[model samples]
Target: TSIPSLPGISTMESLREAMPYFELILDSGCSQRARQFLCTLLEPECQPLGSSVTPPCRNTCKVVAEECSDFIINILDLSQIFKCDNYPDSEDECINLARGDQCFSKETSCGDGSCIPKRWKCNGVLDCKNGIDEVNCTTCNKYQYACESKDSCIPLEWRCDGNADCEDGSDEINCHQEEEMVMHSHASPCPAGELRCVDGRCITLQQICDGNKDCSDGADEANCRIQYKS
Candidate 1:
């Protein structure tokens, strides 16, 4: 098993004991995500540095839990041992399998029910499952305003004008002066290079795309593009 497995099973004896659980999943022909998730935790990728071990992302575990719950939990009677929340969701890097992805508070969405890191949104690659992250990366036309949802382009004058031109009502998510002031005040408390959440929480830039919501407003992970870096 991996050094820091969710189950804390690091010894070969423990791994052999866990073999039955994995065999059941393999025999069931579960989704690739589920299979890969189990394999990653049970037999993680070989890295030169032990600290380089990459655990499965929490979101991926959640997906697998939901997808294979009936089999791994109900049918296999392993609910007591295989809870998905045992894994770390953030504060460090982990393996990411972008499906059923949810954005963090104040974080941008890919307009297709998936969320990514702000830096990855249009860094010249398609990170969103539907390629929405790369769309409209450029500024809208002279007369148009880019919607907060990043899925639509509308007339600039339509913004904050009391009309709902954007489908997500994001055109007015921050229309109140009090809210802007709150954002500004909250921002002041955060150190430089750190993102201030809508609720006044400070998070590191490294935490942005680690597949977790560090900010209550979810701003730390908005528009994160998932791409292989060279």
Candidate 2:
């Protein structure tokens, strides 16, 4: 059945804004069937804006409801798809579905109502089903590189520093290749107080044999010949 065009429920944004009122109605002794219908209408469906089925209208509630009905019908028809009942039996059930998962202190809700860690919001990958998690993300800090995961931003200086700072390992992928090029090029000596390793990389002389392998080939700690002259 088609829903009537309701006042002040035109655009998707307006529908989202009206959700609280819908919830209030449900709580204020609305009929169980009415509440179930409203909850079904509220379920998220991928709707394209400006489609022929969703022409620009001052009140698109009827169209939206029709689309929602079709969406639920299609889901029910899918044999392999498993979802909660087509219509929530209670307001609490509807709310629980709307609040897909518990968010941590440093997390945010996606457009589809799922929660993701805040760090996964804008590193690069689209964690939100609607790609909303990456929208309006804060710009990376100066000299910071964005990871392919779209959830992390690492300092530019940290890239190729013999460490994997980006979760996708993008920061260190070509490090060895660059080092190989430097090795083949002119024999530029390391600056004062810095020692050159076998791989032509440079480290501070102080880093030698202090319980760490600074050199890639372990040359810094190859042999122990400490002499005690008392």
Candidate 3:
């Protein structure tokens, strides 16, 4: 043992002095050769958790080195235990586990049956009272909506100007996808939606001067009533 021995020191208090150097020996946790020398040097025990007569503590690990020699031995590779996802953490029935129940002023429960995150998903009649909760609910139809009042599963807002904002076609009805028009005075095609994705890449005169085509169809540099030098 390279550790300097103490003469009459007893209890965990004495063992603390030599631990820093001993820890340096196992600092390379991957080395088995180092471990062998450490085991011989420290002499730990492989005692059962509760079977130990001496209390286990930080300092006690060094003091009880011989008696608990096997305990300190990293003898084998052990896989960590993993619990199943669906398994309840504890078997105790005394716990009062409320999932997402919030405390309101009055004891009024939103009668959407299951307490899903969104109140609109609960049922047809605005369980959340405010229609905005259901206004932006997910919908599939382009012109139709999943209107709360109608409470129909299918869409109802289908007059496509370009937007499918609401089931009732009440929000922005005549919205178009806004395609860019091509120009003749200048060069380059200004396509509509294509220009949105790009920034001032290379646009043409017909796309811009004609107010149509700096973009995909000349929509990008379109509609510049006043023409400037290239």
Best by TM-score: 1
**Could you tell me which 10 consecutive residues in candidate 3 have the lowest summed lDDT?**
75-84
What tens-digit string does per-residue lDDT give for candidate 3 at 42-129?
4544449764222112111222232222233331211000111211223231111111255222112234321212212423344333
How well is each residue in 1-230 modelled by candidate 1, as lDDT tens digits? 34455464556766576678767776775444567677777677787865657777765665556445546644223453367576666636777644356654434577866555544555466756678777767566645655544556776556557888877664453445323423655426655435466777766433544557777656554554321121
Q: Rank the candidates by lDDT, best first.
A: 1, 2, 3
Clashes of each: 11, 6, 53
lDDT of 2 at 146: 56
* Candidate 2 residue lDDT tens string, 82-126: 132332334333333223445434346786655544445664667
The whole-model lDDT of each prediction reads 0.57, 0.46, 0.31
**Candidate with the larger TM-score of 2 and 3:** 2
- For model 3, the superposed segments whose C-alpha errors exceed 4 Å read 1-85, 88-114, 119-143, 147-230
- Please give the TM-score that candidate 2 achieves against the real structure: 0.25
Where in model 2 is the C-alpha error above 4 Å?
1-129, 167-170, 181-230
For the record, the alpha-carbon RMSD of candidate 1 to the native fold, in angstroms, is 13.2
Q: Which window of ten consecutive residues has the lowest lDDT sum in model 2?
A: 54-63
